[model samples]
Target: MEYARRFPGGARAADLLLCLAITAPLLLPDHDGFAPTGLPLGWMRIAAAPLLALAVLISRRRPVAAAAVPAALGLAASPELHTAVGFAVAQVTLAFLLGHRAADRPPALWLFAGVLGAGGLALLAAPDADFEDGGTLVANVLLVFVLPWLAGQGMRQRAELDRAGWQLAERLERERHLVVHQARLRERARIATDMHDSLGHDLALIAVRAGGLKVAADTSPQGREAAEELRRSAAAAARRLHEVIQVLREGDETAPLRPAGESVAVLVHNAKASGIPVTLDDLLSDGDALPPMTERAIFRVVQEALTNAAKHAEGAPITVTMSRDGRNAVVTVTNDAPAVGTTPPVPPQNANGHGLIGLDERVRQAGGTLHAHPTAKGFTVTAHLPLSAGAPATPPRAASTTREHAATTRRTARRRALHTIGLPTAGITVLLLFMALNDHGTDSSLLEKHKYNELRIGESQQVVEDRLPARQLRPEHRPARPNGADECRYYGTDPDSFTPAYQLCFTAGRLSHKDKVVLSRVG
Candidate 1:
């Protein structure tokens, strides 16, 4: 059944042949148009074959119904069908079809056994013309009925195994997707927690300091009102940020809080009001309408750059630039070095160096990149934010991608090596073993020359072996001369014999000459 799904065209052709085999016997003419029982096959009997074949064709989706109907009809018509070869073939084919198409094995096996028992009894009651004895009847039933059933059961088991393998693969793929999704959610929650805990505390302190300065006795009325507004806004922003972090922690789909559509122009104005000399070059007319997250990221980058410049390089002039290049919104901020011979302010020792790092993470989460580096004049920070919706925020590291590709290539090479080299090497070894086992020339007894006196030059190696008792010879230690002739040698058992060894030289399977070896030791 699995094979049919894999190759539909072939399965359809096979099904066509099965249906024809089952039905053709019904339409076939009996010998001389008469049954052996001297009974004519009426229309009813002839009609039964096609109906049974139709039932078997429908059995692919309904195996039980097909099996029962055909068995009942065949039994009613068994006496007339016993002499027809096609009837036996049809019965066997129906049994195989039923077993192969069964939805469950246990019930199918019981039904199959019952059908076999019924078929055996019917054959015993009305034996075929050729089967004059009970023994032949039983043999026919076993050969025709049981064997096909076993083959169909084998097919059913194989189909079930293939189905199980397919289901397992699908389950594993789903689990892999779920695991990756969970990892991304965890990373987002970690980022949210860090921003709320660290940056939110810093902003809260700024609000309190501004509130204290607003009520001082020396403050002017206009300045006091501005300070009061800044304090309230900062405090409200901090509270809203806490709510956003809580939503992220609970994995809610609610949108996080964002700044009130802040623009680069507003950020530049704030930096100048803070007493840091700054200039702006705005080349983007649509900068204010950027996506909420992208605009927030840009505003934060500018603010962090101005703050870093004011703290470390006071009195240095800073320049901010904004423009749209292709689909990216680009921003760069640079500050000049302090005047010559002017001492720069020293940074505090308690600084954790997380300002630039946090800014970089924010830009990346908005599907952008950030670069901060020192220049010959002073320092510069630049960022690029993508405008496309749903683009991946975090780009994969190049090193990791390369390593994954290398691993995949190694696995492919291993499989190729097994098919290209391992299979051929195994095939050659098997062939060599087959040749060695069947070769008569490898026999040890054929290498011995016991009757060397009867051997003569120009005789074939086969003739020499026949005349001499070729026994107790070693194939590995065969002698060879420089002129390229193969030699076989045998040592004499007698220690005092004048001729201690006999040697026979053969050139191209024909005996060429013989020699005697005399062993003598030099003292």
Candidate 2:
């Protein structure tokens, strides 16, 4: 009903091309007559062109349903046009396009089955049609119809897979972009939260301590004046921090507010007191205290490493080393393997696997490099911090595409191209080879005038056969047998099977009758 939708310009063009192909076999001079079942040749030919054209137009939208049109038309022309090479060409072209155009895979396969069934039925319906033997019948069906349909189906699958691959790639890229954006937001939030809890608390405590010293009675007048200024400056710094942060709280709503600005030594001592075998090897007694950023970086590295060790390597001794290497301060925290027969509970912080991501961001913001990897016997996390304030860098963005992904795509495309082209090419080559090696349908030298004149009606059957050609006329080109002949064999007078043929009949092991039969109309 939707004429506009069903027959667009492109569909019209394809219909024109298909109609042209359908009429091609009829136009040949060798095919002078039409075979119509229960209908005139003119009527069926006029009806079939438009009907088959309609089927071709709808093949893309409805493959299985469109296939029935060709089947009905083929049966209508059976034993005559159905036997022509052009008829097979048109029908097989429809079958191949049906497979290539159908979107659903099951229905494409069904169309193949439908055409194959129709081809077999067409053979049975046209029992008088010429065929060399059983093998030729089956081979023709497979070669002309089944093989082309299968080739189309293979091409369709390859195209669909290629589209699916592109869709998957696009989806993964979307997910990657979203994940990267969310990670950046989460890491920045954690950094702000961490600074407020630890560094802000330290500033507030220093302001409180300066106020106490300024009011103490044992303090000298000059020391009191200096302490007053120190308290005022510390108070101003705390106010500025509060103004920027706008909200401050412990790491968790219920987590106890531990003393702020605890040195790395204090962190190691606390871990030791908590039943973790921890040792601190401090070799920085002679150097000036590290920059605030550097010191904070070191504290977080040790704290996170110790927490991980307690959670993963329970009861294992940990060594926290702080040594100066060149202008950078190096901190290494290593924990031995966990105790045997002990399994640690999985941690929930990095459930999304962003724990180390956050840690790496924290160290990078403090102008430091962090490395955490498996050791020979345990896990080790090392941080290298520049003692002087260096320009901080954000974590590098993840690559949007990789060489491996590109390589995989190229390989898939190459494989699809091969399947789309190679299958049909290989099938056609084998079909050609099979027909070449197995085709022995008609003998041109059988019914020569001289040979035909020498044959006698009362001759012995074996002697007649010996004198005649071994190859006989194909069934379709053979004419009706004369009555009372036990067996009839037709032979082509010329190389072309459609020319006039000689008919020989044998009865009771003796030649009984002979006649001239006209199998085709000469154009």
- CA RMSD of all predictions: 21.3, 10.9
Best by lDDT: 2
Model 1 lDDT per residue over 397-510, tens place: 332333455458667977998999999999998997685432322232232344556677899988876665334334343444426677654544232231345666778898
* Residues 376-399 of candidate 2: C-alpha lDDT, one tens digit per residue: 899999988887866566456455
Off by over 4 Å in 1: 1-18, 25-45, 57-62, 68-84, 103-133, 164-175, 197-218, 246-364, 368-523
Instruction: Report clash pairs, candidate 2.
Output: 130-476
- The deviation in Å at residue 14 for candidate 2 is 17
Model 1: pairs clashing at backbone N, Cα or C within 3 Å: 448-470, 448-471
Q: Residue-pair clashes per candidate, as listed?
A: 2, 1
TM-score of each: 0.41, 0.52
For candidate 1, report its TM-score.
0.41
Please give the lDDT score for candidate 1. 0.65
